[model samples]
Target: MTAAPDARSALRAATTPDHERVDAAFGAFDLTTREGYAAFLLGQAHAFLPIEAAIVAADPRDLLPDWPARRRGERLREDLSALGFPAPPTGDWAPFRHRADILGAIYVLEGSRLGGRMLARSVPADLPRSFIDTSDSVRWRYLIEVLDKLLVTDDQHTLAIDAARRAFALFEAGALRQKRTKAFG
Candidate 1:
């Protein structure tokens, strides 16, 4: 182990590869089409709300004091309705048992906002794609700065890394589930 280890660094290092993988996988999804965007939002709602509920329940005010403003479940819901899609019932997710797990999940969730502007650009001018239209980066920057200061031990770092991986897998599964639904209908 290197000297002066930190949960921030350890978590980033562990998640870098996974982050890259998620970016590529998400990039492969074509959001230019109405059906594509609908499917995207469907899966997004499925994964995001459950994880958001878990972390919000974990009480993140200590770390992310602005959690309320940062929350996006409402926006996702609005987008779904704008597209005339019904919000389907999502299955239960295992609640995060540790603060580190919450942080890891939030890392994935918040990190996603950094790429939202690009996704927003992909939408047709006439379409309502507010879900990915986060043009400002202030919130994203704040989350990073706050995360950088939250001291986590090696054990916590490991758990955070695992949680981040699970977050990605959960999101992908949600998207796949939507695809299957579309195919079957």
Candidate 2:
């Protein structure tokens, strides 16, 4: 009999397309310039604030004890302020109804930190970078441990995958909205 896929692998496989879409959408921003960087942060704020708020409301502490330390919404806000841009209004996000759902969203948020490291190199050194500069491999490993431990059932795995996909979609929408406003141009 074939061994079952682990939670992380399953989620990655399921959401690869959505993840790619988000990467392409955000990749259009020219991060080397202040205008481009600020717009990119604004797009991130629009999606992250609402979703992170919802995750906090759900109280995932039982599943993720370090949830408080993992939040980056405030950091994103600080970057926006430093750029002289007002906080963009957050849009409505899908609710996190289950623990699996919360985990899925966390996956997207944490995974972004890996990508953020690469993007950070593009930003001018003088600019604020608290949000993207903070990438913790230990925290990521812990999250993977939790995901593998808790997402034991196929149903739970499915829920997590769906939630991750939705999170990616929210990010894509946020980037599109920012682009539409032409705030950076």
Candidate 3:
């Protein structure tokens, strides 16, 4: 049997390997506190769900009844519009449509589990990576990585979730230390 692709490999395959751009985008956020990290994930979810929703719409069976995928996509698009993301009039979701099943799975496993609409709406365009022109392909790629871990793992400890939470905490701690050092120096 073929082994599932690793997260980075999946991302590289689904979207351009733009680590520099991704990191630069990530760097734009504070990521130094629980709220900051939560905001970051929600920002991703806010952007992520629209594409995810479309995929779900492509096949509604992928998610729980109330969490239809298409609605998720529409919501994401609506949220983006509400947040003033200028319409990418000519943007093509063909790439997204082609992989609807995979993207739908990602939405069910990742985007749906996030905080809530309020948190999502609270994420503004000025936030980190918020205006980096992220494509549905890139978002799907990232979501696949995150969701694959969250959904596929059998361990109840939720290694991926726990790791992500801890990683954010560590990042926040480091940011705090850096700030202190900068101030004291």
Candidate 4:
């Protein structure tokens, strides 16, 4: 058999920029200003609520074309506020690093439960009972249960969460760099 394409090639092929495709994805979802209220509720449930929205938000960069990192963070915050969550005095969500995983968990949970399937195991039992309150989405409830069952060690979990967090950071940096290059050129 021929050798398989490497990870870089696979990623490049998978992530090829297609504005139409991106637009279509967003179009599939009906986003209203009211979504902010949903986001606020999510935020009140979990300090890390923004992470889940960030994960699924339509073309986050499209939502905020300039000053990506800051704007992206702000949009998430706005969502939280709309959902009725009290903005923290510090307005910092990074203190809670579990956000992305929580997002991922919700994704899987929603997919499995609504679709009538399951994946990535269940949530662990030892995590605080408070974790389940993070969202009104039934998906979020299922995610809390799944998150509680993750088998990865704490170190591995930390690394995974860090990597996911860095993905957003790198995305912001790349967007900024692209803008600067266009401006200077």
lDDT of each: 0.75, 0.90, 0.38, 0.33
Task: Give the number of colliding residue pairs in candidate 1.
Answer: 0
lDDT of 1 by residue, 23-84 (tens): 65455556888777877778778888888878777888887888887788778888889889
* Candidate that beats the other on TM-score, 2 or 3, i.e. the better one: 2
Candidate 3 — worst ten consecutive residues by lDDT sum? 86-95
Q: Model 2 off-target regions past 4 Å?
A: none
- Model 2, 1-185: lDDT tens digits are 98768999999999999999999989889888899899999888888888898898898999999999999988998899999988877657777888999999999999998889989998899999999999899999999999999998899999999999888998998899889988653
lDDT minimum window of 10 residues, candidate 2: 86-95
Model 4: per-residue lDDT, tens digit, 65-169?
321222223443554454455444332233223433433323322322232111112222322222222334453343444444442344434443443444334
> How does candidate 2 score on lDDT?
0.90
Q: Candidate 2 — number of clashing residue pairs?
A: 0
RMSD of each: 2.6, 1.2, 12.7, 18.7
Model 3: how far residue 169 lies from native, Å? 25
Q: Rank the candidates by lDDT, best first.
A: 2, 1, 3, 4
The backbone clash count of each candidate, in order, is 0, 0, 7, 17
Model 3 gets an lDDT of 0.38
The model with the greater TM-score, 3 or 4, is 3
Best by lDDT: 2
Misplaced by over 4 Å in model 1 are 4-8, 181-185
Candidate 4: list runs displaced more than 4 Å. Answer: 1-136, 181-185
